[model samples]
Target: MTTQQSAIYYPAGEIEEFLPQIGRVVEIKDHELAVFRTSDGTIFAAENRNPHPKGGPLAEGIVSGYYLYDPLYDWKIDLNTGLVQAPDQGQVQMYPVKVENGQVWVAL
Candidate 1:
């Protein structure tokens, strides 16, 4: 796990405010990130940008299982590792997320 001590973590919002399988974009300074809560109740955070040629709007992308499928081209990115899966080679910045007392915090 990435230590929370290395960087400041900002509270995005209450965890319950985000709908399941929907990615919410959170901004801290100039960084734009997509935060997601899976249907099974797992939380993930990554860059809002998609790496594919025509893919974009990651926050509005579809969440399926453990991956966030890019809306433009259907490129699936692993939410757990931020790895762009198969045929795509690259990664989005994955932020360390912590939920404490129902609040979601992202380490930026």
Candidate 2:
């Protein structure tokens, strides 16, 4: 049996404030994650996990065509890569997010 680590907690309200500015990437525990805006102003949160063992930091990574590139190893991984990064082998899970009346709602 495999044991999954504890899920990290991020205050949605605080994250929302940074959404309009430069995207913010944060790491909780050993997980790498980021919140950023596309060229079209759509905000998204994605895990920073890298497929390569020597994966770069996701917060400092780059996003291109729905994929995040590790800054250190230059590994191009899908934004939806979830907890694991692989070459068409793994997928990232997404949470339902929405902003209402100046409040951010992230379905856990």
The window of 10 residues in a row where model 1 has the poorest summed lDDT is 1-10
lDDT of 2 by residue, 15-62 (tens): 346544244655544544566555554556665444455544456666
Per-residue lDDT of 1-108 in model 1, one digit per residue for the tens? 234767788888898988999989988779988999999988898988887765466899889899988867767899988888988777878988888888888887
Each prediction's Cα RMSD? 2.7, 6.9
Off by over 4 Å in 1: 1-3
Candidate 1 local Cα displacement, residue 32, angstroms: 1.0
TM-scores for the candidates: 0.89, 0.53
Q: How many pairs of residues collide in each model?
A: 0, 4
- Which whole-number lDDT from 0 to 100 does residue 86 have in model 1? 86
lDDT of each: 0.84, 0.50
